[model samples]
Target: MKNDFTLEVYSENAFSVLNRMINIFNRRRIRIRSLLATELEADYKHGMASFKLHTTAEQLERAMHQLEKLIEVERVVRIN
Candidate 1:
């Protein structure tokens, strides 16, 4: 089943983090439809990294798990 997820990533530079994310996606052989990482409007206390992704439910869950393992990643959620 296809699933759309909004994952809020807390990392330093969105650019570097995105590279790692892309590597993971390539390793997993999952194609990303669209991804956006924007700085949070709040202060630095919130960290500031957000992304939206569209993929299969299984792929999404697996990707989330992998992302959680990365030290740069603080948290992840499957938003509605």
Candidate 2:
């Protein structure tokens, strides 16, 4: 049951954090459909990244849990 899911990640401007986040899906061979980034704060190290991809619910759950564990990640939420 693969369906589209959007993951919104609130994180700092480490940049590396973004790579790690993408690696979560890349390691599993899941291709991200799209990605958008926006600045949330005037300071340098704060922003949000939105990722859209298609995957099974079970896999998404695991990926979300993993995303939350990253030190730079402030929050991770599903948009749909």
| Number of the top-ranking candidate, with TM-score as the measure | 2
Clashing pairs in 2: none
TM-score of each: 0.66, 0.93
Per-residue C-alpha lDDT of model 2 across residues 1-80, encoded as one tens digit per residue: 89999999999878688899999999877669999988788787698999998899889999999999999999999989
Candidate 1 per-residue lDDT, tens place, 1-80, comes to 66666766666554467688667777887766666666654654334344556668788788879988877777776665
* CA error at residue 56 for candidate 2, angstroms: 0.4
Candidate 1 ranges with C-alpha deviation above 4 Å: 41-50
Global local distance difference test of model 2:
0.90
Cα-lDDT of candidate 1? 0.67
Worst 10 residues of 2 by lDDT: 38-47
TM for candidate 1 is 0.66
